[model samples]
Target: MPNPIKVVLVEDSAVAREIMQRLLDSSPEVDVVGTAQDGIQGLDVIAQTKPDVICVDLQMPRMDGLEFTQKVMSDYPRPILVVSNAVHPSDVDNIFNLMSAGALDFFPKPTSGTATDYEKLKSALVTKIKVLASKAK
Candidate 1:
């Protein structure tokens, strides 16, 4: 098998961050290289880790995913996956902006805490990561 895909997760919510890390780590194909609480810190972590793919939240302090995506595309130029729970109408526009800014995909945060829900989300997240990591920057 090929080397596991390196990943950095950036989420403002501590609970969400931990949940995402656990879910990603459960898979053998992905490696959680680093994590951060916000986009500013995310940039620093990304620079240090040099991950193959990035998972970021849309809302956060200091910098949001949109700005972070823009900065990463300009400086590092890697495939990014936006993992967010922004369900509001306006937030859809923000997600689109992120795509235009260079983010390759978006995954909605899970709502329920059931094992089934987690399992489904985990599969989706891992699959998205694999596809994004394989994408050419």
Candidate 2:
């Protein structure tokens, strides 16, 4: 079997981080190797872990996601999947801007309030990560 994809999650909210970790753990093809609470810590973790994919939050403390994405793209150029609660239609332009800046794609914060919500999003997340990771390779 192919090696499981290594993922580093960088999210500030405790609940959101736990939810994401749980979802990622459910995937057989993916592994949550490390996690960070902010962009600075995320950067450190990325450097240390060298994960195949990094899931980051846009509004983190100590260095927001956009800045981190810019730096990572400029230097590391790894696959970055942005997770955010900014789902308003008005934010589409800004989201596009993030995509242009570096992030491969963005996903809505899972709010299903149950395991089913995570199960649905997990499939999409895994597909996205696999595609991006393959391209990065």
Candidate 3:
């Protein structure tokens, strides 16, 4: 069988972290190797796990998502998916900036506080991670 897609989630919110973990756990093809509460911890997890994908929150403490993304791109060149609560149309420009900076995609934070919020985008997210991970390899 093919290797499962290993991922690391970097989210500061306790509720969001649990929900994301549960969502990833439900998918047999995607394996969440580790999780971090902030960008600093996320960096440590990434160094240890070298996961195929890194899902990061935008407004984290210690090191915000943009800074974290910049560091990862410069130092590791890994596939990154940004998760944030900024979903307004104006935020599209900012999201595009992140994409230009190295993030492969952005997903709006789920309002339900559950992984079920990811149901609509899970397939797409997985596909994008796979594609970007291949490029990183």
Among all candidates shown, the one with the greatest TM-score: 1
> How large is the C-alpha RMSD of every model relative to the true structure?
1.8, 1.5, 2.4
lDDT for position 60 in model 3: 87
**Whole-model lDDT, candidate 3?**
0.82
Q: Sorted on lDDT, highest at the top, how do the candidates line up?
A: 1, 2, 3
lDDT of 3 at 9: 95
- Which wins on lDDT, candidate 1 or candidate 2? 1
Candidate 2 lDDT over 1-137, as tens digits, reads 89999999999998899988988898889999999999989888988899998898888889998999998898778999898886344798768778888898887876656666667788988888898789788
**Which stretches of candidate 3 lie above 4 Å from their native place?**
87-89, 113-118
Root mean square deviation (Cα) for candidate 2: 1.5
Cα lDDT of model 3 by residue, 1-137, tens digit: 78888999999998888877777777778899999999899999999999999999988889988889999988777889887886344787778777887988777664453455477556666676677668767
Model 1 lDDT tens row, 49-136 = 9999999999898999899999999998999998888834467677679889999888886555899989998999999999999894
For all candidates, the clash counts are: 0, 0, 0
| Runs with alpha carbons beyond 4 Å of true place in candidate 1 | 87-92
How many pairs in model 2 have backbone atoms within 3 A of each other, for residues 3 or more apart or on separate chains, i.e. clashes? 0
Query: Each prediction's TM-score against the native?
Result: 0.93, 0.92, 0.85
What is the lDDT, from 0 to 100, of the residue 103 in candidate 1? 93
Which one wins by TM-score: 1 or 2? 1
Question: What residue pairs clash in candidate 2, if any at all?
Answer: none
